[model samples]
Target: MMNRFICIPLCLFLLSVCNPKKNERPNGWYYITDRVEDSISLEPIVTINDFEEIKLDSAENLKGKFIYQITGHVAADCVEKWADATEHSIGKRIGFVFQDEVICTPCINCRIETGSFAISAQDTDIKSIYWQIVRKIHSR
Candidate 1:
């Protein structure tokens, strides 16, 4: 009986130390901003009948000066894009936009069905121009 009690406490302690709960914002709209440095634009150059790899240009790197904004929806029933499909309840929907350009915009829809969520934007060159994420948004 005493051994069983000690084992339970030890297991609980180990679990607590090993795995900690992640932090999540309250159920509401939130803004996430970050600037990607040394990132290249993955725009496609030309249209080819056959499969061709796209090239990227690394001319300008975004320093901390560049600011990007994401309008995030925390609730599940906020907006419905497709019919006959259940909207994501726990995960949030984020729309990305650059603060300076205002006109030029690249919005990506992201979600975490099981694990981490990542968003990447490709240009005409089919190269990845921008990438961001809401890290570890879900738990098992």
Candidate 2:
């Protein structure tokens, strides 16, 4: 009986020591400028400039039917140039430069995708542009 009691305590101790949970951070992306000034821990993995080429993921069965909503502060110079060049409004246009080219990939529970859009304005200097990409999940 005494041996059985000791064994139970030892097994419990060993089980506790053997299994540990992992430290998981939030899953998402953010666009920031001046990595040090932003007080943000996540470093920017990608950078974009005017007229740069960006690639987006493609979705299956939902191709060309998804809606993208983009919102961010654009540099004043970019607004002026876009106003003169395109019919898109600088104040409300999202995915203006990279429209119709985003690609979606199958994720664990849903699809994940990302794309970069260019802002063109000769005189505007934008400090940072924050954007998010969300896809409509279809029930299977």
Instruction: Name the candidate that leads on TM-score.
Output: 2
For candidate 1, write residues 1-140 as lDDT tens digits: 99999999999999999995553322211222243831212221111111112122243336533233222322233223211111232232232222211122233244333222222233322122222112223210
Worst 10 residues of 2 by lDDT: 103-112
Candidate 1 overall lDDT versus native: 0.29
Best by lDDT: 2
Task: Write model 2 residue lDDT over 41-128, tens digit each, in one string.
Answer: 2422221232123223323345554332222222343444333322222222222211222121111221112222333332222211
Alpha-carbon lDDT, every model: 0.29, 0.30
Off by over 4 Å in 2: 30-140
